[model samples]
Target: MELGVIDLVGGGGAMVAVNDSTRTLRRTRSIQLDHVWRALETGAWVTAGFRSATPWLSSITGESPSASSVTLRLAERIQQMPQVKATFADGVLAESALRQLTDLWSFDIAGEFARDERMLLGWALKFASGDLTMLLATWLLHNDPDAADKTAQEQFESRELHLSSLLDSMGRLDALLDPEGFNLVRAAIRHLS
Candidate 1:
């Protein structure tokens, strides 16, 4: 039975229907990601007359370019992670959790992730998406402190303070600083001001 907006809002079982629809949508997205992975693996997208998978996915799924790009990248990352791939395929894992895992994933920490996959999946199931993201980030930082340090150093090296004049007599101050630098600058400015 199809649920129109009226039925969705007026029906007694509306919440149940909404919950079921959410599960169905999650499963459908999982299937789509699986197909995207297969297409990437087989070059089926090229044969289907598309230059690349992202555009083809966007065309078919009606997702924006950035969403399609993220989906494509997630598909590639999920392919390398057997346990994550399975959990995602089961549709038990939230998309946000999957994205968080993919975001913090690196080849250097693959083994650690693999070993901790079960524990992480448990947290994914128990925690909200934001909590899961923070948990995964903390896990990554603790497990791969060297990579975290390297990223901090890169950010420090790339830090910039830009002062530009606006149209009137106004000035703009733009800065990109790592955590320590930001704290130091903030302290100095607060003390002086």
Candidate 2:
């Protein structure tokens, strides 16, 4: 099977080219939340090629073609956090809450908090109010007043969320397109530079 290519630009953006049996879809966009959503949609459709049971079409569809299992795995990973686990186990974690919590996991601070489960749980609760980023900024400001400015923190949060969304989309796409493992395409476009 011919795999797609995802080229990363010098400016930290990505351009993806995916080919399905019918047509080829190429997208050039910034690494943002909306762009990731579009990638997910496109990947879902391209991956749908596997849904066809016809043997001839199966060759180009790649192996291990199913996104449902991968989605479940993602949900399970999110549930590993103590707070998320409890909320999910108790049925208190709705789709929106789950999404927010998962999104929060994309931040670098999440790894730091992971070492202390109690703190992570507290932050998870704070995530519900949409103040997690603000609180993190406040902490950073307290630690390094000169460096952790509000604007920088905001940009950091935005980048974190964008990356999180991108990875989430890529996971979905990989589940459908390359089930064995993630096959990230790398390319260099001089024009983008």
Instruction: Give the alpha-carbon lDDT of every model.
Output: 0.77, 0.40
In model 2, the Cα lDDT at residue 122 comes to: 58
In model 2, pairs of residues that clash are none
lDDT at 52 for candidate 1?
71
Q: For residues 143-175, could you state the per-residue lDDT of candidate 1 as single tens digits?
A: 997877776766677566656686998987666
Question: Which ranges in model 2 have alpha carbons more than 4 Å from their true place?
Answer: 1-80, 106-110, 126-128, 136-193
> Which pairs of residues have clashing backbones in candidate 1?
none
Candidate 1: count of backbone clashes, pairs at least 3 residues apart or interchain:
0
Q: Where's the lowest-lDDT run of ten residues in candidate 1?
A: 1-10
